[model samples]
Structures are given as C-alpha cells and as structure tokens.
Target: MRDGPAPGASAPTQTDMDLDLAPSPPRVEDLIAARRAKRQAILAKYSNGTSSTSTPVASQSSQAPLPALLIAEQSITRANSVAMSVDGTPAPEKYSQGERRASMSNSPPPLSAQDTAGDIGADLDKLDAADNLAFELAKGDEQDGMQAPDQETISKLEGGHDQISAADYDPSRDRREDEHKRLLGEVPHKPKVEDVMEIEEIEDVEEEDVDDMFAVAMGEPSKKTKKVKKTVSKPAPVLITTTALLDTAADAEGYYSVILGEQIDGGRYQVVSSLGKGMFANVVRGLVLQSPPEAEGILGAEVGKEVAIKIVRSQESMYRAGLKEAQILQKIRQADPDDKKHLVRLERTFEHRGHLCLVFESMSMNLRDVVKRFGKDVGLNISAVRTYAHQLFLALSLLKKLNIMHADIKPDNILVNERKNLLKLCDLGSASDASENDITPYLVSRFYRAPEIILGVPYDPALDIWSVGCTLYELYTGKILFPGRSNNQMLLLMMELKGRFNTKMIKKAKFQDAYFDEMGGFESVERDKVTGADVIRKIHLAKPTRDLRARLMPPTSVKMNDNEAKLLTSFIDLLDKCLALDPSRRITPREALSHPFIRG
Candidate 1:
C-alpha cells in the first residue's frame, strides 16, 4: 500500500541515505563506563552467588563480547588446575578451535550443568581480580614512564607461577631498576679513592691471615704473623792510597779487600796475618779450621795447620795465570806422589769473593832470608852450600823429567825449613810447560836471567840450569853475582864474564840486531853522563875479561884450607858447566846431579 508521493523536498541524496542507515558511533568515555559497569555487575553476581545459569554456552559465546581479562583468567585457571593435579596423569592435548567445537558438539558433557555454571562463576571472579590488578599496575607504569606488564605476565601471575621466587626473579631487571634509581639521584655516589683503599686493606688482611687459617684447618699449629722488613746492604768503604803499595780496600779493578781475621772458603780457613804482597797476588797466612784429608798424619801437616793462601788479583789476566799455576802444581803432585821431589805442595784451591785463592804448605823462610840471616853478603858455609846444592839438583832433575820449566828462579823463590836442612822450590807462578812457545823474554829476574833469554834464543830446561847457576852463586856468596839493573846491562855483564857470543849463536839469536851490529860487533846501549839519556854504541870485545871459574872462588875476605880448596875447585867446575854461553852445550839437570860438587 504505497502511495509513492514525494514532492518538493529535495530527493534524498545518496549521502543522506547512507547517513540515515549507519548506526551512531559510541563515545570513548561511554564505552569505558559500560565496561566498568559490566565488570562490577559480574563481580557482584559472583559475590552474591546469584549469577544467571540459564544462559546457554552458545548464547554466552555469541551475545557477550569476549573480554581480554576473562580469557586470561580462564587460561590461567585451566593451567593451574592441570599443574596442581597430583595423579601424575598426562594433560590432555591441546586442540584447534574447530576441533574443540566439533568435539563439544559430538561428545557428552564432561561436567554437569551445575558444575559448569560454578566453574564459570569462579572464572568470572578471577577475571575481576586480575582486571583490578592490571588497572593498578598500568596506572603505576604510566606514572613511572614504563610499559605495563603484557598479557603473558598477567597470565603467569594469575596462575601463581612462582611469583617473586628465584625462578621468576630477573637479576637483569633488578640491575636496570638500580641503574635507573642511581640516574635519578636515589643512591649516593662512592669515592674511587675510598673504594681502592678498602679493597687494598682487605687484601692485606687476607694475606696476613690466609696462611694461619690454612695451617689451623690442616691441624697444624698456627704461626704468628710476621712483619717483613726489607734490608739493604751498604758496600764496603773505598780506601785511597798514594804509594805503589796496594790497598786492602775492594775496588772496581777486581781486587778483593782482605779483612783481617775474616773467615773465608765457607769458614774453613781464617786469615791470620798478611805474609807478603806482589804485583799479581797477596799472600796471607791462614789457620786451617779443618785440615784437608791429604794433610792428615803428614809430619808438617795437621789440624790447626798454618797455610800460605795466595789470593790472586781479580784482574782477568792474573786469574788465568793463577789457574794455570794450580793446574801445574796438580800435575807435579800426581807425578811425585811420595813427595820426594823438593817442590812446594799445593794443599788446595778455592774461590773467595771473586778471587782465586791457592793454599800451600807453610815454609819457615825463603833462601833470601837465609842469605840475610846467615850468609850476610859474605857467603854461606861450604857444607851448607853442598847440602843445599845437592837438594837443588834433585829438584831440577824432577823438573826436567816432567818437561816443566821454572821460568822464575831466584833466592826469594826457594823455601827452607827452620833448620835450613829441608829446601823446596816454590813460586811457580811464572813457570810454563817446556813445549810452550809463547814464553816471555823477561821471565826470570834480571840478575838470574839466562844468557840465551837475553839473546832471545829458543830455550829449554837448560835455561833453568843457567838460572840455578846464578842463584847458587848468589846463595854461596850472599851477593847477586850478575846484578844488572836493566836488560841492556844484563847482557853486557854476561858478555863481560862469559865471553862474546859465537858466530853460530849470534846467527840464531832472535834479538841479535838489538845487541850486535851486522858485522857481529857488540852494540851496547849506554847511558849518557850529561843527558841521562840512552845512547847505543858499538864495542869490540874479543874474549871475556873475567873467568867464571875465578868469579866462583870464595871472596877475598875468606881463606880456604886444602879440603875447602878442593871443594871450591869442584864447585867452580860445576858452575862453569851450568853457565855455558851456548845453551846447546850446557850441562843438563841429570848431568849436573852427578857432578862432583853435588854428588861428592
């Protein structure tokens, strides 16, 4: 029944029609108020136990909007129920929505209608509580400028999933909160210096007590804490000296300062007195605290024994020379085990304060002291000379047998007993093997130097015999027979007594040009009286001015009897053979030992 009567009013526009058909949009405030009202109504229903149970599941699902808080509460309640089951039964497998709906349609209800209504009511109560908690939390988060906890966190909390327990406590979250609080000036700042001092103090306390604690725990007696004090040792004071004599002070030059009464060598030897000093070493008499095994039961060797300790200068050259001397002495000791050869015995060798020290048997005095005490520039008795000469020949024979050269031989180098009967050759510091070619030309003292040494001729054990000849003459006469102040004077004096060098000897001499001209005349170096400068001049001497035989005779102050004259003649003959100008014709130690002067 339509009378389609439209007129005048502008035909309804398309927009006006659409607007009339559309429903009015709800305001945000109205929606929020409605939600709150619904929540309160649900909460009141659950609290009064008067919620409508007549509502079917389908009507509830279709008509009522699903709220986030209600969904979360249902999920959490189901999870809690499954977790709290004590039957040890497996939980039902989860199903997709379609599968759940289909199953619900086909299967019988797992619960009674009343029980399902009660569960729904309980779930609504949980939802209300969760919604309140969320609202409060969100309000706090907004004030703090932080995001509120998400849906998952709310679910976990409603399920009572270990809230605030170690499993749920986040150390990182706490750290972040602490950092935020510190940035907001909620915590006081600590000073770096105070922190460092506190840490150091703790470490010191631990160090002082850790050992004691460990000891006590191990059932050991606890030790008292000891405060360690560091000590620094000051160097010995330096001594200054102006004379040529060496100082006892330690120096950078490697000289060990000898302190009197100081014990050295591990307290085995105590220095008693300084015996003597030389350019290369210092000789000190030491009291042996413990006698060496080798010295036991020997007549002159015993405990509390006195030994001459020769401490070599710390210089490298002197140390090496001292080492060589020790080796040679060891060889000598091995060669003559019976100690019959009249050579000084090396007791031992050791190092003390960086200096090589050699210990030897202490002798009463040297031959120089003998000459000074008994001979006194005149001469020793013929009987005494005969005894000493016999012993001297034995020592030379031993040296020749061993192929060793006593490069230094003088009265000062020979040692004797207090009675002057026992004699031993000592001071082999300059001695070398006979095969050594690098021998020093200025080895022997100038007064006792052999003629071949002055001529620079290659020498052998015979050179030692020449030195022995010169030494014997000095011992017998208590005077240096050929006392030359320099090498030039030494050669001149030798030529004056022995004779001019023969052509054959001069041709082989290494230093012949220095003492002789090309024409074979003596070129002597003499001091000028006016200038005190050396001047070389040629001298022609056909023969020796003084005979060695005459030189060996007793001094004019002494008179010889018949027996003395015969002994003197034999002694002169021995001297002549030893003092031969030509080393090749010189009498050897073995030959000299059998001479009438030594054997008879």
Candidate 2:
C-alpha cells in the first residue's frame, strides 16, 4: 500500500493504467492436490519395496499426469543435493531424519534414481523402482540396522490395509525393461563355428584355376621371384593379331614411365617423355618387357613385348576425356584379341607417371590429318573412296560388337598404321555403352554436326554416321557440305539443300531471329502461334555457306576432278541422309557402315 495516494495521484483518468493482483489460476491448486495424491499412492503401492527377479511394473494409467509430477521432481532434486552435501559424499539410505538438521532440514529422505524415474514419468519410474529395490534388499541383508525391503517385500506387506507404510516405488525400472523386450526380441548372438565352415566349403576350388586367376591379377614377377618360384614365362608375339581397319600408333624406340601420380616414390606411374600427345591423352613408345609364366615361349621373339604405351591423361580436367577413351579401348580389346579385326585392342593397362596407361600397337598418322593434307580431290575416284570406306566399315563392325561408339569419329581420330596394314577407329570421349541412355553428344565440329542436332532433334549413334559422311565428303571434294560458322547456320545451309524453311523444323529449333527463311514471302509472314515473340524468317547464314556452295557447284576447281565430283555428290547424298530433317529417317552407324560408298 503506497503511503496515502499522493496528491498528484489525483482522480484517475480513462487513459490511466490500473492494476488488480488476483490469486493464481485454480488449476495450480488442482495440480498441487494431484501431486499430494500421487505421493500417497507411492507410499501405498511400494509399502514393502522388495523383489527377486525384475518383474515389470504395472500401472493404472497409460500416461502419467504432468505438472504435478514436475513439482515432485523439483522437490526430489533439491533433497538429493542437500543429502549429498551433508554426508560430504552421498546420502545413506538408513540416515536418521532428526540428525539431518545440521545440513539437510528435518525433511524426507532424498529421492534416488527410482524417485527421479517416477518424476521422469511412468516408464522410467518403474525402472528406477526395480533397481533401487534390488539395491535396498541387498543392503538389508548385509546390515544389522533396520533397512527397507526390496519391491518383492510387497507380497509380505498384505493385510492391515489401513496400516500406513512409507516405502517408495518408481514405476520406471520395470516398465522400461518390459517395453524394451516387447519392442525388440532377445539380443542377437554371434554366429558359431558351423556357419564359418559352410562359407569356407563353398569357396574351395581347383588349384590350377586358382593359380591362373592369381597369375592374371599379379603381373610377371621380377627375376628373383621367378627364380624362387622356379616358374618359366613364355613370350607372345608383338602383334597378337592384325586388322586392316586399325592403325597402331606404337613407336619402337623404347618406353619409360613418364609421370608418377602424386609423389615420385609412390602412387601411379604415368609416361611423360617420349610421349606423344593425341586428341586427348598422352602416349608413350615402349616395348613388351616380360611375359607371364603361362605366356612364356608361347610365341617367338616378335611376341616378347615391344609395344606402345597410351597414357590416358591423369589430370582431372581431362579425366572424362581420358576415362571414356580408356574404357572404349579396354572394351574393344576384350571383344576380339587375336583377330584385331575390330576396334583397337588394349594389350593391357599399367601405371606410368601416376596415370593408368593403355598398351596398343602404334600408328604413324591419323586418317583425317592425312586425307586433309595429302588427299587429292581429283584422285578421289569411286574406287579410292571405296578403299577408305571399306576399312572404316570393318572398324565400325568391330566397334558395334563391343557396344562402343566412336563419338568423336572425326577423320583425325581415325588412324591407319601403313606399315602394319591396319586401320583403327579411336577416340570415345563422349561415348559410352549405348545402353546407358545418355547421348554421346554434339561435340563434333560444327560442320560435322548431324542434321538432328542442328535442328534440336534427339539423336544417338546416328550422329556418328553424320560425322562419317562429313569425313567422306571432305575426302572427296576437300570441301565441307554445310560449312557454317556455327550449328545454327549449319542447319540453315542444310535447309537450303531442301529449298525451303521447314516450319516444323523451325518450331523444333526454337530459334529467335536466327532461322533463315527461304520461303518467298518471308518478310510479310507473321506467326500466329507464337506470342510475345518475334517471328523471324530471314537469317543471314554465315559466309562459309557461300564458299561451300561454290565448291559444291558442278564442274568445280581443278583440285577436284570430275571423278572426285561424282564421288563427292554421292557422299553428299550420304550426308543428306545423315542430316535428314526427320530424326527417324536419319542413317545409323551400323547402316552407314554398309553403304556401298564406304564398304569394301
């Protein structure tokens, strides 16, 4: 009460703040009453705390009431602290309540884990009760002083229902045990000896087969190991087999480990020097150094390991390019070993300069670079074109069998080992097992793009055939068919071949104003379907288009004789099939290989 309301406190105004402090919510009294009842129930339920085996606790309610339980928990926590302090250690279960005055007040015994369990709720309460009861019973057996019985003593506490007892009980100890067992089965046990024996029996196999597998996993041993093992190795031929289509790029000078992955002393070996750089990976010249015991004397000196090391680049930037190429090489090698009639075979993979390198027969030059420089358009007679084309098909057939696509099948990626009399299809960066559902890509140079890619149509191996057609076209006329600056123009030039702008193609291409409109009234036409977008028709195709058309004109330059022109027109016809406006009508890799132009 403030000393007589100050004169300034005058008359209260409507805007003045007021106060009325009232009693707490009636719920608080209800909660206190509930807690008192629970305390009484505790004394009754666990009147003779005692037990033998840890039987689960039984409860009348599935879930315990809260706010009342929380208050009891706070009281117990404070008791535990005070008891522990007075004892200078922990509270004794048999402490005299009156002697508790010096430190702990004349209060109840401190709650143990069991008491806290009850506060924690039904499940924990029983758990704590069972454990605490067990401890109390054991202590009573050892002490002469009066001691409380464990929960099992409840059975003896019968009769005299009106009698008051203060034994404590926490429902947590027993409930938790029953809940755990009910939710999960008995703990799992480890397998015995009999299980181990069953697994071992199944693994046992023939000794020779085991040895063969071991020898394959580990390369031929050093001389010391060979002598100790008393095993002899035979040499296989340098060229296991040969294919006219594959051109090995191996040089016989000598091969050495070039680059080591990570540190020089550890990790992978990668061939660095004497290494030739290709469209992607690094290649080293080397020889077959040794043979396995099984391979010994199998062939003559020719087979004694003189080979070229194709070091796939270990640099992360070029990893995709290298991995794809290596995967393709390994796959082809697995398909046909001795015949060499298919794709280039990888003799084996080894570490050099930290990179995993492929061993293959080497070739001197690639078909693309060779044809681009030395190929005479005038001499590109049908027979001449057929010779190259046939070799290509053979390679294609072999590659198809392995499910390998030469995604970057430009002329340069193809090689012809003249001395070895072989042609090899190489480079598979964007390639993958065709079953992977991923497209190899429009990675080829713009001029070599298949019509579908330029037209934004879905494609697959059909793209490779388009590249092949482009290569053949260059070989025959030394001129590109749709040599536009970019993919968009290439599409326009392709449309010119058809004499009109394909409306459906335009829709698919989704070009803004870049589409070349060849139709006569292109300027006056307005698209009705497209909204908020400019309907462009006339696109200025790149200048290269003009040059390509000039080169393709009949009776062309002396560099391209009539015979070559005849070959070129046919090649152009093939290119047209590959660049067909409709993807479904496009030529495929397998079918293109069978065309008379490229077939042997």
Candidate 3:
C-alpha cells in the first residue's frame, strides 16, 4: 500500500480493494479442483444428514473445501477416520433424486436386530387376537343360518337395549329402510307409479303422464302440462288395461275385434265395438278416453268422443297401402279449406302392433247399408239420391281440381252421417294421382267398372263419372245396371247399353286381342264340335240393341208426380252422358255437378 489507512478510519472502497489485492487468474486444473472440492463438501454434509437445506444440491462455495468428499464416500470414510471415530458410526447413506423419491413411497418398515423382544411378543399377540375374532365371526354366521338368535344373545350385544330380533321387529322396518335409501339417492330407485313404462315407448303421453294416469286410476281429476315431453331417461311406466290381450287373433274369416274396453294409444282411446272390415284393414268403433285440445271443435268436436279406427293388416304391403291412403287424405285436407264439408275427416294416424291405424269421424252407415235398408229392388226415392249426389259431386270436384282419381268409387266406400243427412267420400286406399295417358285398366268394382277399363283403353277421370252413373242407377232402380259375372260378360252388358267401342278406342287398347278380333269385333269362343270335346271356332255374334229407358225405369212403390217425372227424365239423361261408350263423350265430374238432376 502506498499509505495504509489509519486504524478506526473509513474502510477502503470495493474498487480500491480489488485492485490492491487482485491475484493472477487461476489455471484450468485448479478451477476444476476447486469446483470438485465444493461439490464433495456439499455431498458430505448432505450425506451426513446434517445439512440445514433439504435439497440435494446446495452452495458451490460450501462444497469447495472438502475435495476428498468427491473421491467416494467410502474412500473419504477411510481417509477421515476422525469423523467415524467421533461418533463411532458411518455417515448416513447418500441417495440420488430417484432413490429419494422411491424411499418416500408406502413401503413397510424394515425389520432390524435392534427390535426388542417385548415389541415382537406384542405383535404376535395382536395377530393371534385377530385370528381368534375372525374364527368367532365365521362361527356366528353359521349359527345364524341354522337358527334365529336368542333374545338373551341379542341383549348381550353392545347397545343391547336398542337391538331387537327380526321376529319381534316392526313391519315398518322395510318402509324405513326404503325411505332411507331414497333419501340417499338422486331419485327414488323404485318406480313411483307401479305402472310406469319407458318414456320413449309412450310418446303421445303428456309430460305429466304419470300424474294423469294415477289420477284416472284413482278416480281423480287429470292434471295438464304445458311443457312437451321430449326426452326422458327413466320415465314411470303407464298402466294399461289387459282386455285386448285375449281377443287379438283373427277368426276363420280373417276378421277380428279389438276387444271392447281395451285401451289404445297409451290409454287415450278405448275400443267400444267392431265397426266393419276391409280387405287390408279392420274398422273399430272407439271412444276417446281423453280429449286433445287441438282436435276439439274440429270434425264435430271428436276429441274425448267416439270415432272409427281403421287398423290396417300387419303385412307390409297392406300397411303401406294404408299409409298412402292416409297421405292422400292429409293432402286433401291441406289442399282444400272446406275439406270436412265433402271428404271424410282423417282424425289421427298411429301404429299399433306393426299395423297402421287411422282414426276417422264415426259415420252412421255407408251407402251400401242405405241401399240394403231401402229395398234395392224397389229402390230409394229420387229425393234420397239427390241429397247424396250433391255431396258426392262436391267431393268429386275437389278431386278433379287436385287431378286425383277415386279408382274404386263404390257404395261401400261412401259414408253417410244420418244425423246431419251428410255424405262423405271415404276409403281412399284405391285413389291415385290421375294421368291422361297412364291410366291403369284394373279399376273399380265389376258392377261399376267403366267400359273403357273393361276394354283396356287408357282413360281419365271420366271413368269415375261412369262409376257414378252405375251407382245412381243402382240407387234409383235398386239393381246393378251392369250385373256382369265376368269381364267378357261385363263387356257384353256394356255393349248392350252403350253399343260397341269405336275403331280408334279399340286400337289403343293394350288387351284388345283378349276381347276383340283384328276386325275390331268380339272374339269368337271355343265350343265342342264332335265327341263333346272343346274346339276353337270363329263364331259370329249379334250386336247389342238394348232399350235404356225400359231397362233403367222399372215399377217402384215410390210414385212420382209430373215434376218428379221430369226430374227423373233429366236424371236418365245425366246417366246417358256419364255411361257413354266413348270416354271423350262421357260426362265430366264438373259437368255432372251442373246437371239438373244433381242441381235440382
């Protein structure tokens, strides 16, 4: 120092001290030796279990002093006998990070020779006691199975006053246990209603379906729900009557009844009686168990009321046919604002046991029943015909506008409401979209079949007019106008009434050869020549020359006045236009509606 600082004077600045006592930079070997020494010192301290810091790594400066600690703990132990001599014990073992973590896990404490005899003896006694207790519990289980526990044994148990034998216990124990279980769960495990069903299966039921079902069963009022039941995981089961189970089989005639008092549509409807049967469906009279709000005041307010349920045959083809009929009926409702005025109302549609079921307003009877009720031979009065004809025309007009055809326009398919004196065109299963050039020849009942269909000619809705003429003739004369037993017979009957089909009409017929020759005349039949054996022969037949007026007008008890007779003539004239042999000359539905017979 140039001039040492005086005692008790200010300390030297950090920069001044660094410059005055600064040594030469250490060699690489010395630097490494210093670092190793520091690491060894830290390892010794930590391995000795004497470090304040719990972490394995500590300060470098603290470890730099003990370089021997880096050689090996065992070598250091041999070098530093003083450390062992002081304690007469080796330093605690050093552990790596992985070893340390492993040692912290739940492993049993290791046995040591240092364990006292008394501690070992105590552990043995504890094991023996556990073994004895387990054996006694097993004995008790066997004894319990063999015989009921005595009262003395029950009273001897802990809290004996509170315990009771099962024989002496109250029946209310089950109720208490169930309530306790229910309280512990999110929802009651047992069904709240004994009759609860899968929610998905009974979609028509309201959200409060359970409540309503219970209410009805208990003879209480129903509760309404505003919210719709869209999804449910474990909805309550619904109660249904078992009346229909036994009578669900078809009889010899393939007609079966949906038993009276049987519930359907989740108990919304109850079967009252069998209505009738069709080729592909069964009609039943049903009473609505509960009125739906949407259906109220529509179709004579049929909700919670009586209706006709047509359950189609379970076969896929029949079911699909029924669905088509339902679709057509729905289309009619959508197309016409005054649908209910002329067409039979389709109240609802649903599936029941794989069959398509259609619900419709219950009608008193059909036109066939009316014809049967009024002696067919004597025929119904002209007034009755006019009343029904007007409503039928309204229906036909609607169909014409939609370009749809009632392929099977028969008396059985026409329903009448006797109460209102109204007629509804029903059974649209045979109805189809009309096509001018694609008309199907297989159409209508034999008695009401148009001549064009019989001759296999492409026809339009004018075919329906021909059906109306036949229907009216039957209604007026109480006899089928063309009561032909077979197709050829029917054609012959038509020929007698309206003469033969023209050359062009015959040419267009696909099955022309079936009924006619190349000359556009009736094909000759095969007859027996010799040995009474049948032989093919081209036999000639006479052309038809029947009197329409004399055949249609027969003696009837229902007398007619001058005005009535005039109306009758107009009626016959309408039939003439409708029953024309040529489709082009046939009366249209629209034109028929304006005829004096229909309007009058």
Candidate 4:
C-alpha cells in the first residue's frame, strides 16, 4: 500500500499537515493593497458620513489579514508617501465599493515560487538600504548640532494641522476655520508663495541673530568679540556773562603755561616757556627755527630764539574775533613795520589744528607784571607810568588816524621791552573798525570800562581815552580808580568820584533807567534779587573820600617832594582831561600827547 509506512511513522500527524497546508505568507503587494483599501474605506466613511458594519481588515482581505510584521511594513511605506506629498497632489479620490473591491482583487497574484522568495529577499535588502540612508541623514544632523525644522514641524509652526475639533485646535483656530470655510466653497483664498515659505525659511540664525534681537529690544551694546561702533559727544557751550571773559588776565600769577620744549606750527617753532593763559587763548613763548629780519631785532640774529605764539580757541564768537584781530594786525603791519613804539608787531599768522595762531615778537613782560612787582606800598613810579602812557597815547593816535578803535585798553594789554625801556600795546582782540557802531555793550575790563559804555551811550574812540585814564590811575596808585562791584555800582562810583553824569548825556544813554532816576540823580540802589544785597544803598554809602590826587600819591615811606608835587600836578591835570565825563570834551590822544605831563 505505500511500500508500507516507514517503519518509524505510523500515520500522518495533524501538526505536520497543518504546517504544510497553511497559506503562504502575504506578499508585499498584497499587504500594500490591503492598507490602501483600508485607508480608502476610512476616508469614504468620513467624507460621506456613513460607515460599513464590516471591519477594515474584513473588507481588505478575502481570507485573513497579514501578520503584525507585514502590517508594520505597510504602515511605514504609507507614512513616507504621506510625508513626501504633504504639499503635493491629493490622494486618489474615493470610489464606489464595487470599484474599490475590484482594485483590491486586481493586485497581481503572488510571485512565482522562486521569484517570490527572491523578491522578498530583495525587498528586505532595499528596506535595509532605505533604513541605512535615513540613519545616515539623521546622524549628519546630529553632528552639525544645529538642525532646521522639517516640513512637518514648520507646518505646525505656521499653524498647519490635521482635522480636529475647534476646542482642541487652539493654535490659529481662526485660520483653521478660514481654511475649513474655503474648502467648504464659502470663499476663495489663494495663498501667496511667500506666505507659505515665510516660517520655513527662518532657519540659519547664529550669534548675530541674538545681538540684533537685543539691539531691537534695548539700546544695548554688542559683545566685545564682535565689531563695535564708535560715537563721539561734543562739548557744551559755556555761558559767559562777565565783561572780562578772562578773570585770570589781571593776575600774572594766574598764568597756566604750556609745556616747554614742545614742537609746534609744523615744527617751524619750538616752545621756550609758557607766557600766560586766558579764557579764549593760550600764549606760549616759542623759539623760531629761521630768524627773519623782523624777528632778529626781538630775538637777536641767533636762530632758535624766543618769540610769542598766541593760540586762539575755535569757538565761533572767539574764532571770528581772533580772525578779526589778525586782520587788524595785518593792517597795522602794512601801515607801519619799523615803528615798535605803537602796536605789538605781528610776525605772521597761521592755523594750528582748529585754532588760529598768531606769531609775535617776544617782549620781556607785560605792564601788569611790572605793576605786580611794584606792589601796593610804593606803587608804580611816575616815570614808569609816564613812559608807558606816552607809548600808549602814541599807539592810540596812530590807531585814530587808521580809523581803528582800541576798544579794550588795560594794564595787561601793554607789553614792555625792558632792554630798551620801551612799551607797546598788545592783544588787539577787542580792537574794532571805527564804523562798527553795533558793538556789544560789554567790551572792556570792568575796572577800566568807560562811562559811555556803562550808560550805553553812543560811543567812539573817546571810550579808549576813558579806559586809558582808568588804567593810568591804577598804574600810578597800584589800585583801580572806580572798582565798582557791578555796572549799577560802577555808575554810582563814577558819580561819587567824578560827579554825576551830564543831564543831557544821561538823557542820551540807552540804559539810563538802570543807573539814574527820572530827575537825573543817582537811583536808589536796589537789592540784587539773587544775592539779596542792597547794591545801590551800599554804593551810595561807600563813596571814596580820597580824590584822584590823594589816591595817586606815594606811601609815607616814599616822601613826595616839590619835584614830585609839580609832576603830580601835571599828571593830575592830564588825568582830569583824560577822565572828562563828557565824550565831546574828553582829551583826544593827539591832544594828550602835547600836554606838559606827557611832553615833559
């Protein structure tokens, strides 16, 4: 009967039979087809709001569904396709059950026995290759340490999401509703390409991004490691109110000297010593590299001998004044190069940095220094004052002929040549064209400010004569003749010393009300609002008892003899003429030169 059953095998076992008769494992195509069918059924049910009692597996498979392994593979392939085509074409439209069933049934029959085994192995290899490629890409991203969001992540950022209930989808719920309504044929919303790409492209931000964000939020400076921007602040303007912008010019000890032995003016001159400093300019003694004919007389034929360089600041008002002063010097130099008796000789003018530079012939010292050395005890000798005064008047006479007004004449403005016992007027910064009628009221030193200037009357060169008279009184007595604390007090001092202003002159003054009553006498001095001091009452009560003659006399230690008295009388007469209260009657420089006091 079958050559008898093998001696060991009695009958065919159920286990063996079951194993051999089991249907072949589902093929890759079968699994894919089954999954697609399942998805289509779900979509169809959702779209039409209908459902089948049949399970997805029952509808997709004729006999039985594949094992878990095959299901997993099907899920993976479907996921990849969905991700790849997120913004691509929509999936094939849902069809009738009959058509779907036909499609499911039409999947090619299982590969032939040999081919099926070979394909399965090849597919395993392909899956492995795909897995390796994916792993490699993921590894590369890890190595870089900075990863851009994938399409799905960016879609979430941009409020792209799957279908969900309004309550569940909080991010961009309005946008979701809008999209939903568009799909429902309520409105046509054509998204722009830029709108779609906006969030996805914002990826490659580094340290610079952090800095830019910080800058936008707060005006914070960036890290030192990065490039930095530099900003510069300008100096504020000084509020100047005083007549003498330079308070230090009167005190020779107040000089702030420059560094000695410093090269300047393109190395043509070297610093010798500091001469002095003022609010608007710095004067330094310099040595010339090449001695010109003009410099030879002042500094000798020796090269590298002393000269004076006045460096004026670049403030607008001060700069224009400096340039104007230089122009005046240029005019004087053109007019008289050989006369050292008049104005200080300007050797040349140049520019240094933002300052105006004036080179001048060096002098031993200024008249103020000489006055300081004489002290208040003995005071300056009459001979010295007479010599300096004569030189000053000669200069004034020349200036008058030139139609120039030396608006500021003070002790410090006069320079002395000790070697020759000669004097010259310097610092023509306040000199003006005789035609400049609109000159500022605050021009000269307060100690020497003219009566016309104080009362704001129309003034001319006669203002210089008043200033000279005041300066000469100080030179002789080692004290200011008026020395009022303020302009109002100064007018009172003028009245107290030289008597009241002429009623006509007072009427002609622009600032008459400031100093005089309607009756043309001294106004009751009012208290300073800021200082709370009775200014006018103090001035009225503080009138000096000593006349100009008594003030100019020497101390008891230095006796005044007959010769001194005669000299003093001539000096007093000259002073009285120079100190005339009336501008029309004030002594002219031409007239002052011929007086016995100066002529002697």
Number of the top candidate by TM-score? Answer: 1
Per-residue CA lDDT of model 4 for 1-600, tens digit only, reads 112223454453542221111121233335447655655554333223312222334343543322322432343344333322111343343344454344334222221223322333344344433422210101122122111223244335435521111112122222223323322333111223333211111123335446331222223333222221111212223233222234222223222335678776677788887776654577998887765555456533367667889977555566688889999998987766545336888877776555677888788776566656542422355665676677788778778767898876877788866322466788887788888865234557666778887677888889899989987876665555665545565676666557656678878887776555444445444445675644232122222333555444433345445665677778888998988888899998867776788766
- Could you tell me the lDDT of residue 181 within candidate 4? 36
Per-residue CA lDDT of candidate 2, range 59-104, in tens? 5222222322334444444444433311135544222333222222
Structure candidate 1, residue pairs in collision? none
Candidate 4 segments exceeding 4 Å error: 1-259, 291-302, 524-532, 535-546, 553-561
Error of 4 at 416 (Å): 0.6
Best by lDDT: 1
The parts of candidate 2 lying over 4 Å away from their true place are: 1-275, 291-306, 320-324, 337-342, 376-381, 398-403, 419-421, 435-442, 454-456, 498-537, 540-572, 593-600
Q: Residue 384's C-alpha lDDT in candidate 4? A: 59
Model 1 error, position 87 (Å): 99
> What ranking of all candidate models by TM-score puts the best one first?
1, 3, 4, 2
lDDT of 3 by residue, 1-600 (tens): 233333554665543232212121233335436644543443333343322322334454355323323223333233333222111254232345454333222211221112212232333344333322211101122122212123344234313322221112222333223223322332212222333322222123334435321222323324322211121224234322122222335443233446779888777788999976665567999988776566666545455668899987655455576888899899887865444336888877876655578888888787766666643343455656666666676677678777888877767778866322467888887677776344433456666778777666777777788887777766665556665544566776677557667778878876677676554545322223443432222212234455556444433443546675677678789889988989899877657766788656
